[model samples]
Target: MTRGDSTELAAALRQWRERLTPADVGLPAGPRRRTPGLRREEVARLAGVSVDYVVRLEQDRGPHPSSSVLGALARALRLSAAETGHLFDLAGVAVPGPGRVNDVVRPSVLRLLDRMQDLPAMLVDARTDLLAWNALADALLGDISAVPRERRNLLRMRFGPGGDEHHGPVDEHGDRGRLDRSSVAGARAALARYPDDAALRGLVDELLRSSESFAALWAERPVEDRRVDRKAYDVAGIGRITLDCDALEVPDDDQTLIVYSAAPGSPDAEKLDLLRVVGLQKV
Candidate 1:
């Protein structure tokens, strides 16, 4: 299986290529962005790697990757699906496929979410799919129960404009410009793994068809999740709110557990309480 290193690198190349974006995710495309996708140099900078190393890997140069390098690549490129698996495979780690929910939250982790009533908390599967969420957090996003099961994805919502008009809880702020820019970065990062994924491909097509900004960024394919990134939102009647979005790594699963909270009992906290009242009143 060690010889499969070339295959891994080859997969990574395709994944990386599909996930890159220039100027969208802070990668300067210069005058050569006509083709869309990564420019090789951006991958190097984001992954903390040498340009030559990226070239070698992209070309299937038979280089075995170290764990640290793989982790760095995963973070830098916002790799999803096959891309993450390929990274692990290059490093001789086993990878799971789509819809593979091997993650089971420990009691201690669940307890942590329950105790932090001041915030919105939920667990997302490895593919960045929301698996479970507290009621307060659920209100932040639409009725989690009401959202279509398949469309419960963050990157897809933003990148795949046809998928959903709004980002889950992420767009509570009214800064459409900021949301547009950041969503492109996130989509580029998240799609690095499954370049050929039908679902992902569909979303990309939708984005390209809808927003001009999305079309430009989609072409660049920048990758990197930077999961803990912060965003502001202006939900209808909710006023302005800020939430700290972070990914908590869990064992045995690629799912990310998330928590959202306002600054120490801020007005946003009361707003969340209001959300509960309004959300339940309709039921």
Candidate 2:
């Protein structure tokens, strides 16, 4: 590889690493130590790389890191999506494009989630991966964090089993067919967006083979606009409540910010408020 800003890249990585603590990454703070931030070994463990590799990168004493390595480092450091892109650029690696699913949520989108405290808000990538969600969303749509990263997909929950009852697309209104069609159409749109992504392709292929409905829908190639829709959810302890669901697309990142809110002063709104309080305690 051609020599680039090795020193600058090293410095940047060190700065980011030094600014983050173990608690930020869901690790215990433990007893006080000499280092202000995490150690190189801790970073390596979190990033799924070896201590030697992290040392090499930080000391500017080895070859350039790969895209996957950089991605792991970005996640380990809790960098914003934009910061992750910058990390790739600093390493002379091309940023992931539209043809790839970007799981990272923009900082602006996160801020919006924070602002919508009373409403249920979530962010999902093109592949339907649950990138981020608010507490209200966890209450209304079930806890996305409880599932494995690969299985935290809306379409998967839709066609899979009743086990994911809380996370499944089915509402209290018994609209399984409608929800299935929407999932199929959403999958089609994702396929059109990232035709070359192997993971996405594998998912579609598996669905086509396993689900006859999915196969039929794939044949039809129907596309639906899910920007705004009405949904009724049967949340535990709250019975059934209908809410207005709006999906705001972030075209640049190929992600969608989905927000669900009940009408103000409606009975459903009051139930949602109660859910928020209960959900906070449960989560």
Candidate 3:
């Protein structure tokens, strides 16, 4: 980043800090007649930065901080996940993360998804990148488990044409565009939180290069994720498939638990049964 950009960021941070109130930070107003806003010491203590550093930062006299330090400060300030991520972005040190996913699923969460046996359940990252799913998910969908590790990502499937991994052709004029756009929006949001992440960059770049549709939507920089949404899949062998997919953030409220439900006693549900009976799907 340029020097001007750095100073601008520092100035912005100062303004943001001053505007916040005690309630904004879950703190007391204490005594009045203080600095314009949160005290340097208060912010420093909360952010684990030295008061000197805070002053230097506010004054634009300090060097740009590393992403780790920025994240620590973000945590200390009790920033909302999206807000925290944006803070890092302004600081030009965005943390490269695709929602924390080190097998962090809670047992209860897993049990909950699994219990909805009739409905295919799966957990996807903030990027709508499928993380984990029940056996029924693999069966009802096009054996995503059969997918190689690198190609397992949902974005790659829809947009990574150069990839050998194949699913039946989805008609863009139909509902595929809706599902594709929704998922891409989720992925773009995640990329914003991790702009410097090389792996994510590669995936996004690949998708952009492979599909003109992906290219156009990516440019819009949408924020349409973080809630319940559904998609219909045209799975092979099973013929036309429709899934009422919903995104549910688990206990951590970070990772997404995307569950795909078929209507009660619907054909989709019937096809799902074949997976269990035919041994075509498992974990």
Off by over 4 Å in 3: 1-104, 162-165, 168-173, 265-267, 274-283
Better of 2 and 3 by TM-score: 2
Question: What ranking of all candidate models by TM-score puts the best one first?
Answer: 2, 3, 1
* Candidate 1 global TM-score: 0.51
Worst lDDT run of 10 residues, candidate 2, spans 163-172
Reference-based TM-score of each model = 0.51, 0.72, 0.54
Ten residues in sequence with the least summed lDDT for candidate 1? 99-108
lDDT of 1 by residue, 173-246 (tens): 44565556666765565456566555556666766787677788667765545657566655555755676677
By TM-score, is 1 or 3 better?
3
Output the worst ten-in-a-row residue range by lDDT, candidate 3.
163-172
* lDDT accuracy of residue 199 in candidate 3: 57
The regions of model 2 sitting more than 4 angstroms off are 1-78, 86-94, 161-166
Model 3, CA-based lDDT: 0.61
Note each model's CA RMSD in angstroms.
18.0, 5.3, 15.6
Q: Candidate 1 overall Cα lDDT vs. reference?
A: 0.59
lDDT of 3 by residue, 180-200 (tens): 667678787778776775657
Clash count of each predicted structure: 27, 0, 0
